[model samples]
Target: MEIELVNCECCGLKEDCTQDYISEVKAKFDGKWLCGLCSEAVSDEVKRGKKSSFGMDEAVKAHMSFCGKFKSNPAVKVADGMRQMLRRRSGDLSSSSSKKFMRSAST
Candidate 1:
């Protein structure tokens, strides 16, 4: 298995990967190779079926644009990614103090 250095199309992260693995990722993401994290993120979007017309190409493009915005600062990139994840898991954070769950009065 020959190892190749590949850069992620979306997040600009680089990794040493087997040629077979790289080709497999390119096949899945429209000829662009993505790192594990990015591929998983894009895959998640596809699985959600949030947009009827969205597909792998669109998801890759969307993530690429998102990563582009944060490429200058790796710290900010991670922070923003975490924020987005939190929002996705906990609903929108627009109302900071609304409430997550009612306080169970079991005292």
Candidate 2:
């Protein structure tokens, strides 16, 4: 029942989760806790790696390296955030502009 702040071993994402939840995640990721997204990615990697010699540990390490690369790039992170924001607001932006056009036309 106690909530604790925990950081994902792979991505360093912080989440306030119950102790039980943290333990569960750690147990799943070879005793290293991963965030939900990282865990899913690792799971997918494991499934795909079945064709080769890859396993859970390898997937976790590969994902950790991938996340670490992104952490070192501030510009990429900003650009990515802006891109996501624009994508989400695109519909609103378009509709608002159309409304402004209609109002001007009626005036």
Cα error, candidate 1, residue 96 (Å) = 31
Model 2 ranges off by over 4 Å: 72-97, 100-107
User: Clashing pairs in model 2?
Assistant: none
- Would you estimate the TM-scores of all the predictions? 0.65, 0.74
lDDT of 1 by residue, 1-107 (tens): 78889988887778899999998999999999998888888999888756697888889988888788873634347768999999876765644334433334332
Overall local distance difference test of candidate 2 = 0.86
- C-alpha local distance difference test of each model: 0.80, 0.86
- Residue 17's C-alpha lDDT in candidate 1? 97
In order, what is each prediction's RMSD in angstroms?
Answer: 8.3, 3.7
lDDT of 2 at 91: 78
Model 1: what TM-score? Answer: 0.65
